[model samples]
Target: MSKTQQLSKIGNFFRAFGSAVAVAEATRLGHQPVASDLRALGIDPVQFKSIYRR
Candidate 1:
């Protein structure tokens, strides 16, 4: 697969996983772990925070 396609697939996986995790945690704990949510979406909060801060 092309690099773009691979990246897109990864993104899709992250979105699906993140959503699932958010729902599960909301059901079990009554609160969402936002960092875990981002991680499920294949994102690192530390990395994102750094980039976003700029």
Candidate 2:
């Protein structure tokens, strides 16, 4: 697959995983992670923050 497609697949996983992580953290904090913010996966394709959180 092309680099773009590869990134997208990775992005999808990151998006889903990140959403889950955010939701978990938010739940602990008494709030929910907004789904729209993570939608950046479509435009930005992988969030470095998600792939390499520190």
Candidate 3:
């Protein structure tokens, strides 16, 4: 996707998360929770630095 399209998708996710938080105090995700899934676990999400991305 183009940069703009990627940003739009990220915006959509933020909107979804905002709505979800408003609807319920907590959001659940399937399987074991990893560091990346922390947001769904009602905690702050963190991004680890990868050689390519960071």
Candidate 1 Cα misplacement greater than 4 A, ranges: 30-54
Please report the TM-score between candidate 2 and the true structure.
Answer: 0.49
Off by over 4 Å in 3: 25-54
Q: Using Cα atoms with residue i matched to residue i, what is each candidate's TM-score against the true structure?
A: 0.50, 0.49, 0.45
Q: Each prediction's Cα lDDT score?
A: 0.66, 0.59, 0.50
Cα RMSD of predicted structure 1:
8.5
Top candidate, metric TM-score: 1
Candidate 2, residues 16-49: lDDT per residue as tens digits? 7787677568646765346554454332324423
Alpha-carbon shift of residue 36 in model 3 (angstroms): 28
Q: If both were scored by lDDT, which would come out higher, candidate 2 or candidate 3?
A: 2
lDDT string, candidate 3, 1-54, tens digits? 899999999997896676555434323322223443455535543332121221
